[model samples]
Every structure is written in structure tokens, then in C-alpha cells.
Target: MRTRQRWPILVAATLLVAACGQESETPDVDQNAVATTSCASSGELTMWERSGGNKAMVDMLVEAWNTKNPDCKIKLTYIPHTEMVGKIAQGIASGEVPDLMGMDLIYAPQFEKAQQLVDLTDRIKDWPELKTASKGHMTVATFEDRLYGVPLYADVSALFYNKDLFQRAGLDPNKPPTSLPELRAYADKITALGGDVKGYYLPGNCAGCNIFTVGPLMWASGAKIEAANKGDEPLVGDGVKQVLQFTRDMVKAGNVHDGDRAENGETFHLQFGSGKVGMMGTGNFNITLAREQNPKMNFGVALLPGMTAGSSASFIGGDLVVVPKGSKRVADAVNVMKFLLSDDVQVEVYAKALNLTTRSDMVNNKYFQAEPLVQDVAKALEVGRTPYTLTFFEQINSPQGPWLKMLQRAYYSDDSLDTIISDAKKEMKAIADQS
Candidate 1:
């Protein structure tokens, strides 16, 4: 959740006045002098966030802040997820960074290492409200024994199926696939329909999404990115190979699309919406887009299929709010963080934005329970895992990343499972070494 709106000048002036006069013991200085002086000198709190459909939620929070603290002003900026890291790095180097900003959990460690983020550990420890918040997500925000940010949203992947397509394939619409074998069987049945239709669809170009959705397939098989001591080479385990081969099988079976058209921005939702795909692995956000695109389509969501060795474990992704080092408004930013974590605001913002809540206590809040898919996503959060380390973002997103290339080769080329996996291990080793 990020924004691009300009800072509120009035709010800054108000905060400045409160900061200056709250410490004054002089009876000679008029309150108006405090207000005017503070207004004239107070700087705006600039914040940067991702530009999605969640702008309204940020606006509502800022509005609420202004209502409660009329003197503090906030400036908002919107940065796309793709450019957030680069822009923030440039801003930090120039000493012109914002007071507050939203960062992805995967990339937060880099900022923390750069010494550009404020340590919120003390505040978080003292604040009971934040302590009981989403401990799972907060784990990502904490690094090197200090908390650097507060998670703002929770996102987890789940299986979304076309109920109508399931019924057409002679499957029960009410019973979604719950295991890997069952999912594969259902996909085969759906593909048998044959007229421009697919059993499943996942974008070959989406490395991050694949990690969130397809990565689970490997985890379900009990494989992981191997970690080793000293100079030992990290390797992909058996489960990793199994999932990679599974993806290869899906592409070869005509159950999924792998052409250049799919590579050029064709989303899984579009294929599912058009009745060309019967099922997809997606996050909760996809539900909104799918409903908007095809109101008449019948769909149901369920937990990702479990593997023989591994339980269903999806990847969790979300944004975190951080205070920059040396920010003049560190105290105020902490206050805002606490407010955002408050039960009332968390519920309000999550209710309107349709994003999952990071607070454990808020998981069963009435708002989330009202929607079936959202409820499934909330449950998925209980069992989800993030990439093992912060470097996971760069490792997977870089041009030479193993995940993207592995996915592409599997989908677009005739490379065998062995070759693709051998190449992936080398790439993963390089990434681990760099880290």
C-alpha cells in the first residue's frame, strides 16, 4: 500500500506548534506565537508506497491522522513495486529520503543493512498492541536483532477454481482439489474439454508470483533452497526438482499456455475469466480483478494442494512501513505506526482495501470472515512461509535469476527437466554466494 499525494501543509504546521509549545514553560509567549512559529518552520512528513488500487486506504488513514492531530501534515508519493528499491536507494544516497515509506518485506533487509532505516524494536517492544500483531510477518521486518518496520498488509497464495468448469468436467463444484494428485487429475479432466480451454494457467514471466504459487509445489514435496556452512555450495533439493518437473509436465500437457502471447503480459485471471483456463493459483487480490472482469463467472477458492511429504505451504508477501534514519519525525512516525496497528484502523483499512490483515487477532474479524476466498487466504497465512532470507527478492527478480529463467525454459523451450534443474542449481549457488 503506497501513495503519491502531496504532503498536507496544514498538518505539518499543527504538529510543529504542538512539538515546540508542549515543552514551553514561558507565560510571556502567546499560544498564537507558538502556532505561527511552528507552522512557518515545520517540515512535511513525506511517505512513499506502491501504486496499486489501495491508494484509497492510505488516503483514509491519512485523513484519520489529520482529524486526530490537525497540526501534523503528511506528504504521500507513489512508487511502482518495480522501481521502489532503485528510487529509495537514490533518495537515500542524496540525503533527501522521505521520513516514512512502505517497503516489501523481502527488500527490507537491504535497507536495514545500508543503515538507512530507523530501529523500531524498542517502541514495538513497549507497545503491547504491536507485540500481539502478526508475529509471522513482523519476523520479516526484524533484522540483526532490531525491528526496522511494521507490516501493513498480509498476502498469501491460494487455489482459485472455476466452479462452472469443474461441474462441466463432471467434478463436484463444492469440493475443490485438496491434494496434489487430485489437482492434477482435475486439471486433466478440465483440459479434455478442448475448445481453446486450459486446465490451469500461471504466467511464465512472473517470477515472484511463481515463487508464491508454484514454489509451494516444491515445498509440498519437501524440497528447499539448500543452505550450507562456510564455502559449501548451496543446492536445490529433491522436492525442488520434483516441482520444476511438474511445471514442465503441465506445459507439455497443454494444460497451460506457454506461448509468447502469454509471456507478453497475459494474466492468469484473463485466461480464467474468458473460460480458457479452469483454475489458477493466485493471491486474494486476484479475486477483485476476476470479479470485475467477469461478473457472471462462477469460482471458488481453496487451500493449495498438499504434497505427500509436505503440507500445503504458500508464500506470504506484503508491505512494511519504515522510518528512515535521522528522520526529524521519528517519534511521530512511531505514533502513526502504532495507530495503523490499532484494531479499529486495521479493520477499517483492511475492510475497504480487501487486503489480508497482519494482526493475528484481526484474522477472524467479521470483515474478513464475510468473504469465503478471503477467509481461505487468512487461513493460508497461518501456514505460509516467506523466502528464507531477505536476499530472496534480488535472487529471484534479477535478470540472471534461476526462478524466472527456469520457468521460461520450462514453458517456452524443449529443455529437459534435468538440464533446467542443473542450470537452476548453478544460478541459485551464485545468488547464495553473493549473499
Candidate 2:
């Protein structure tokens, strides 16, 4: 019999707060007392993770810990992908939160502000291996000068093109398009083949995926959400308008498909696997799914096309493991964190999960060397940058969320590019004011 799933109430609260821009104060901890207590042992720890492949990986980690420690055991909870954030929030609010959690990078900042997380700075300062294993992702897990979590895995978006589609379109399969104009030319060629084929497929519902897909386009074009504050003079100017307009153009050209409305990363993969789409902006997970669904599907991964800058950068998104602020087993938690970061575990877990590793040492491991898709992902990682602020969830879900809608509308409608961008900028300024 299947068990009933309980949604964490705190997650609902988080979603509400994220969407509405409400702030929740972190529970106060007596730092002096917490610092003096040694790590506890033999306590039952609860860990929550998303289902399917991700769940399998967390389970493997738990098993390894249990076999070696014997004294400490973890109870694993599988949360549906759609409900993970809400359930995690519910768990936190009820004081029944998991001892450790595997969370997406987008939610890290929100959790950090709530003081729901324990600072791992002191622990990491002495552990060279853990520091080395983080592969620059620690920056994402940090907020206000405090380290809140240890990265479990890292990933970035890339263009996955069907080699067969490229060849059929009279393009070299070995050399995928590297710039926007080139991509448009190649995609047009693919679409010309007709019959339910689209040049590109990107999800419209998944905002997180959009950050990876569309955000990079803006960055490549020398645009950003805003300019860095170097004592006055705002950095963001007209470039933002230009990038949004470009996305609108892609939509207008029919290069992007409507199928994204009901699908997500997995559904997008199924579509791509069937040869219905020629190119997609997706993550490493798609490589595995594509291989399983159609072993003969000729596909190659490439960095997302560049703009005038002639360079590409992707928004990195993945999971990190953090100990809650009130956990009694801080030492043991640190120990487990260390083990997870070890080279042996990084390669083993990455091999099984097929996710990218955070360590530089693991980039050239035999597993990645054997898979061209993985290798491409590693190459893209070299140019990766996380979103500028931890309020990413709020930034994406707010009234500014209309920017995304505007992009889709501009793409699908006859609206002028300037109108779409001007409207989006107005909305963006409103959201920034709230921050």
C-alpha cells in the first residue's frame, strides 16, 4: 500500500511569504550555549529529499552513513518535487523539521534569512577537503557573510541539440551553434522540416528552469537584473530591455514551443527524446533521460549561445545539505557533511545520480570522461554564476513575475519589442523597490 504524504505547513508559509514579500524572523538561538555543546549521538535524524532519482541518491548516502556509523541512523522522507518547499516549510514551523535537508539553490536565501539554518563556517574553515569539494558553490549557500549549507551537487543549463536534426538541417553535427544568430539560423532550418517539429523547446511554467534558460540569454547580451551598486550610478540600463526583447523575438519566430505549458524538465525530455524538438535549454539530468528513452537518438550538448559579448554564462541551480540551527547533533552533522564532500563519495554519488560534481578534482573522473554530455556540462561550469541575490524566489515570483509572462506574450503576440521591454522594466522597478 502507498503511504499518505504530508505537506510541510512551513513550505506553504514560505511560498506565501515568497510570493507576497512578507518576512519571517528567524528563531533566536543562544550562540554561546550552542557553541559549548559537543555534537550529540544516537538521535534519530530525519532527512527530506525529492522523489525518484534524487531520492535514490539521498538514500544511498544514508545507507553509507548508517553502515559506517552504526550508532546514528537517519529516517528518510521522500517529498514530491512539486510539494518539497511547502512541506519543508511546514516541517520547520511545526518544530518537526528534518535534521538535514537537500534543498535547491533558489530557496537557500529564503531559508538563510529565517535563521532556520546553522552556520557551517567554523566547521568548513578547518576542513580543506570540504572547502575544496564545494567548487565555488559555497557562494550560493552564503547570505550576509554567513555560511549556511554545504553543497551536495551543482548543475547549469546547456543547449542540447539533436545531432541528427542538425545533420538533416544541413549543419555540421559536430559543431553546434555558439551564438544567437547562428542558433536562430540552425533552428529555422530544423523547423523548416515541418510536421509537429519545433526549433526549440523551453518550459513556460517552471520559473526555475526559465532562470537557467532565459537568464543566461540576458547575461550573454550584457544585460542583468540590475547594475551593481558602486556608490550611485545604476549599472542596469538599456541592455535589460534588449535581452527581454530578444526572448520575445524567439517566441514570435515560433522557435519556442507551446508544449512547455504542461510539462517540466522531465516532460520536456520526453518530447525531445521523441525527436519532436531539435534543441532545448536544459540540465544534465536530460542527458540520462534521453539516453534511456531513445538510445539511438543522436544528441550533443553545447553552451547556450552568446550575444554580442561572444561569451555565455548559465545560472547554476542544484541542492545543498544544511543542518538546522537547533539540531543537537552538530558534530555528527559536520562529520556527515565532511564525508559527503570527500572525493570518493563525490565521484560515487555523481556516478549514480548522473548530476554534476562540485569538486574540480571530479571533473575529469572516468565517469564524466565517458559521457560527452557530462563533459559539456563541466565545460559550461567554468563560466557559471549564481543569481546576484538570495531573494531569488521573491524576485521571480513577485509582480515582476509578469516579466516572464510579458516575454511569452511578446513572443506569441504582435506586440512591439520596445513595448514589451518597457512594460517589464516598469514591473521590475516595482519589485526592486520592495526589496
Candidate 3:
């Protein structure tokens, strides 16, 4: 969900040509080369990764791989997450795609369906290590019962609370809200503190912020913003209305920051990190960032609550490592993926950095156990879900898309809730059908 770039529609014609290269007589590409389960004995590899928190982790893995096998060295390039999809699309069009690419999971279906990703179903299906990977990400990486990628790292949304704010407000620091009613009550209590302090904060102008954070509330209560099956309409259940109403109520109560309505995600986390906000909905990457920004700030993390007390969910947002269709070093790229998934990297590297590992079994490692905040997020990642749709970027992640329009109207506008929901379903349905 940290991905903020606007991506253009992947030209269907360009992808078709990229998947099946031109009939050039040049020897650079082998027309008959195809993805295989076997690993190359030696080769050079090029991989493009998204920048941000994940950059250091990718760099470490690449260095380790190069040290282990100098013959199969990987040349890594950092691309802004915002520019990743469009750049990849352009790369495909120019027949210059990377051998390995770490992409946002939401775009997996789009590329997989376009035949621009290499199928690794047979390669990883029986690999014993595959059983330990995040099942949620694996679901997003699959299309038509075939695998195209593996989880590179995970970033799921959860509720972040300021412990000091809670204690100063006379609320128990250890006890965070677990339901919609409790959340509102907590927000009101915190907001009562007055003077530059706010009970809750959300990047009102950020579609990714709302969807990755607010979306879990709807999902925990059994609602959906996108259809699971292609061509089906989105199921905007009572949960959806309830979540929207909850946000509207919070706004009306002045429990949210006055400036939040105009704030985008660019500095939302920093505001929370400043120690004024009582609660915020954001991703796990902030766990380390919050500490770095304010070393003394006592914070707690928990799953995003549902309408009721006992239910919770999170947005399973992260990058997936995929080998492009025309990659000449598919085997070498996959070998890198395997090395990354190994426990040595998943636990020692990622978990030690206060990040969630792609493998669920590694959640209880020594590093996570030592940090309750990280542990709580690890639990959220297991139960989180990523929306499965080819039009995810266009219909939801896009700033100008209908999803943001509906979300804006739901919270800030004077429109009726019924009208907002109705219009949203229609717009989402139209986009879903286009896929």
C-alpha cells in the first residue's frame, strides 16, 4: 500500500508482443527459451525492486547471493514504487524487462493475465520451503490455478496507538480498543485532552491510506470492495456502511485532526510519529520508523478492529518477486528467490529489522518475540487479505478513481450514505466488468 505512483493502463497490444517476442534473426534472444524448474549452473541476472523500507532488505539479499555464488550475480536496481508498474510496462514494450522484478501484489493478476510473467507453478509447487510462505500473498500471485511469483516481504495495515497519550488521558495504556464502539470512545477520550492533540488521524486525501487501513474494518465485518470472481459485482455489505458511518461519526465528533481532510500519505506517518495523534491506521513498516523518529514514544500495535469486539483483519499489502516472461535468466532469478525465502534471510535479516517475514512459520522467531509491536503486526499479517482483481490499480489505487471519489463523499461530503454506497457499487462493477 506504500505504492503511490499513478500507472497507465497496460496497453494490451504491447503486452501481447512482449510475451511473444518479434521474429528477429538476432541471437540475443532464444525464441524457444521457456521457464523451467531447473536452475542455471551460472548466469548474470538483473532485478528491479521498489524503493523505500524494502530497499535495504533487497540489497542485503543480493549481496549475500553474490557472495554465495559469484557466477550468478544479480544486478539490482531501485525503482520508486510509484513508477514501478509504468516502468515495467514500458520495459515489456521495449523488450527490456528485468529477469527478476519485485512488484506490488495488487498488480500480479494484471501482469499474470497479460502473459507477461513466467509461470513458476511447477518449480515451486513441490518445494518444501513453499509451505512456509505467506498464504495470503501466494493467493494473489496465482492466476487460473497457476503460480507466477512468491512473497518478497509483507506490509499489512494495523491499528497504531500512542501509549503515552493513552496514559495521560487516564486510559489504560495496555488496553487498546477492540471494536467500533470502543474505538470511538477511545478517540473521544483522547481528543478531550485538547491543544494540538488529536484522538485519531487518517490521510483523508490518500486513497492508499484509506483502502489499506480503513478497508480492514469492512473486511473484518464481512464486506468487500472488489469482487473475488471476474465479472462479479462487489459485495458492499452492512460492514461497508458501518465502517463508513463510523468514520463519518468520528469526523462529526471532531475526534479526527482538522488538517487530516487535506493531508495525503506523504507525511501522515510523521504526524503520528510526532506523538500528538492517539491512534492511526497504517502499515507495519512504520513500526521501525516511529522509533527512529521519536525514540521515547511508547506505542502499541494491534489488528484493525471490526464492527464487533472479537473480530479483526488487516490489509495484506507487499511486493511479490516475479520472473518476467522474456527473461533469459529465469532459473538464475528463481534461485535468488529461493535464497531469499530461506530461513537465514527471512528470520535473521527481515525479522531482525522489525519487519514481517514472508513466511508465517518464522513469525515467532527471537527477533519478533522480543518486540511486542512487531509481534502484533506479525499476527495481523497472517489474517490479512489482499483484494484480487486485475483492475485494482485503476479502480482503487488511482487517486482520481471512483473508489477515492466514493470514500471522499462518504466522509467529507453531504451526500446520503445510501447514495454514496449505491454509486460506488455501480462504478466498481463497471470497472470490474471491463477486466
What is each predicted model's overall lDDT from 0 to 1?
0.65, 0.64, 0.79
Give the per-residue lDDT digits (tens) of candidate 2, residues 282-336: 7766787788889999999888766653577676666788876455555666667
Ranking by TM-score: 3, 1, 2
| TM-score against truth, every candidate | 0.82, 0.82, 0.92
What are the clashing pairs of model 2? 8-87, 8-90, 9-90, 10-89, 10-90, 11-86, 11-89, 11-90
- Tell me the tens digit of each residue's lDDT in model 3 across 1-435: 674644544353355546445421212323233423234656777889877646777777677777877877888899876567767766775678788988878778877777778887876776667787877788889999999888888888899999999998999999999998899999999999999898998678988788888889999888888854457878468998898899998898988888889876778667778888999888888888899999999999988999999799989877899987667766677677777788888887788877788888888899888987888888886778888887776678778877788788978987998898888888878877766
Cα deviation in Å at residue 208, candidate 2? 3.3
* Model 2 poorest 10 in a row by lDDT: 1-10
Global CA lDDT computed for model 1: 0.65
For model 3, name the residue pairs that clash.
5-82
> Can you give the lDDT of residue 406 in candidate 2?
59
Compute the lDDT of residue 183 as modeled in candidate 2: 78
Query: Considering every candidate listed, which one attains the maximal TM-score?
Result: 3
Cα lDDT for residue 229, model 2? 18
Per-residue error at 255 for model 3, in Å? 0.6
